[model samples]
Target: MSPPAYSRVLLKLSGEALMGDQGYGVDPAVVTRIADEVAEIRDIGVQVAIVIGGGNIFRGMAGSARGMDRATADYMGMLATVMNGLALQDGLEHHGVPTRVLTAIEMRSVAEPFIRRRAIRHLEKGRVVVFAAGTGNPYFTTDTAAALRAMEVKADVILKATKVDGIYTADPKQDPSATRYDRITYLQVLEQGLKVMDATAISLCMDNKMPIVVLDLNERGNMRRAIMGEHVGSLVTV
Candidate 1:
């Protein structure tokens, strides 16, 4: 087999992806499935990092808009990410994959504080690192956090796993005419208003020249297919 397409990568998974069929919180089975996919790559010497969103437990922006304070809502969302991070770490470890969870909020007892250098060291040592908490601040999404962490860790690409297979011209479910582009320029995504990621996240990734692959994780084997550069989904590059 050829060498892995990337030696290091940052994977962005939403909290909802962990919900499996039940559609709430985390489903151990779903996390295990994801971990297995990751372990496959890990065994091949690919350094993996994960940044998970907290939408399944709580979306700070969504809650704040409903009456909660924006900052408080975002903090709660960050904490929720911590929960998801722990779950992911546990799931991965159960599979015998070495993993570490780092939190932006500095939860000493449950996890280590987010340290860029330490994270890189972990990856260098062949341990998967899960970045929790969204930038350790309010008014930011975990997507943005993923971008920032990707850049900080010098990852080759950011793999954004979503419900959709790829970036579409419009919501595929709502519009049958919507088309999925195999490759897209960041400029095109920004100009066309494609919903691959939030504007802030897109801007951060684009500014850093960090390539991204958007794919659907609900499908088995897709993640491995994606890491192998098998034309699995939309590729966003400058």
Candidate 2:
């Protein structure tokens, strides 16, 4: 399917999603599969910028709840993202797709520093850029980081790859009668308190007028469909 009107996009993937059903850390096989999907999308002509979370390995909130300091836990979470980013970079390269990993926190040994101009230049040259580390700070979620990077890269849309297909009225796992939205407005999402993404992340998108497409990453080629602006999931736009 032809994409609606996206020249470039930022994909926000949760780390736990990369773990498949194992519940913690990345499953190499799963990460490869995700990379393959991304590679396929890239082949179709979408400049992709990705922000991967570290919840699969460690979540700052979970660690802090267990008596770990919030800032330290967040830093550890950032490190986890670096590991995941490295794995993704390898996976994409193995598929013959040129990939670059950039970190908000400087990690010269592993990836390049996060520079907006450099990232755009790479994308222009047909390279996929993976953004790691959560905004180089604590007390923030990767979702916020994704929003930041999306804006910096001048992404046309935010493609949120989640476990569920789209935003639903209720938790589909818990409520059999839950209904999914085909499309939605930012105001409605905010007023309804939907949980597709965090308030801060949503606000960033709304303020920037960047549409967010929430689709299931488990479905093969769903990311491509989302980029094409097919009715794949709920589109949160102004």
Candidate 3:
């Protein structure tokens, strides 16, 4: 078989993705399914790194809007991501895939600290590295951390998994006339204010020339198909 199109990729997953129709918290079934998909890609010689968000358990912006201290709320949000990371690590390991959880906040007891070289080395050795703690700082979203980590790790692309099929003119669920774009440019996403990612994340990707494949995570085999360059979703580039 031909080699997969991407040797290394960063998967950006929202914590809400782990909730699986539930009100809050992770669903074990959902985690296992994602782990199986990730393991499939790894078995094909792909190096996978993940950066997960924390909107399910806690959302910093939501808390801040409700009168909590912004910084404190953001910190709590980061901790939520760490919990999701650990849960994913468990699922991955249960699938017989070697996985590591690295945190930006230096929780040596639960995970290794985020060292760029160490993260790369883990991937080099065929271990999936899940980055948690949101860049170890408040005020930055995990999307930005994903872009930064992808650049630092020199990933071939970013697989930004979402609920929708791909980038659309408007939220497909809300707008009846919305049309999906099979391929879109970074600038177009920013100029149009599409919700592909935050401006900071998109700008970072645009500056670094990192491509992002936006696909529906709930769709089975989509991640592997994207890794194989099968035109599985919207491509954001340049």
For TM-score, the strongest prediction is: 3
Candidate 3, which segments miss by more than 4 Å at Cα?
Answer: none
Residue-wise lDDT of candidate 1 within 1-238, one digit each (tens)?
8787888999999999999888679999999999999999899889999999998899998998899999999999999999999999999999999899999999899999999999999999999999999799999888889999999999999999998899998999999999889999998999999888788889988888899999989888887787777888899998
Worst 10 residues of 1 by lDDT: 220-229
Query: Per-candidate TM vs. native?
Result: 0.98, 0.96, 0.99
* Per-residue error (Å), model 2, residue 56: 0.9
Q: List the residue pairs that clash in candidate 1.
A: none
Compute the lDDT for candidate 3. Answer: 0.96
- lDDT for position 204 in model 2: 88
Q: Per-residue lDDT of 84-189 in model 3, one digit per residue for the tens? A: 9999999999999999999999889999999999999999999999999988888999999999999999999999999999999998889999999999999999
Overall local distance difference test of candidate 1: 0.92
* TM-score quality measure for candidate 3: 0.99
The sequence of per-residue lDDT tens digits that candidate 2 reaches over residues 1-238 is: 5554688999999989878889787788998898899898898888999999998888899999999999999999999999989989998999999999999999898899999899999999999999999799998889989988999999989899998999999999999999999989988998999997788888988899988999988889898777776788788998
**Selected candidate, larger TM-score, 1 vs 3:** 3
Q: List the residue pairs that clash in candidate 2.
A: 3-228, 4-228
Highest lDDT model number = 3
- Error at 105, model 1, angstroms: 0.3
lDDT by candidate, in order shown: 0.92, 0.90, 0.96
Model 3: clashing residue pairs? none
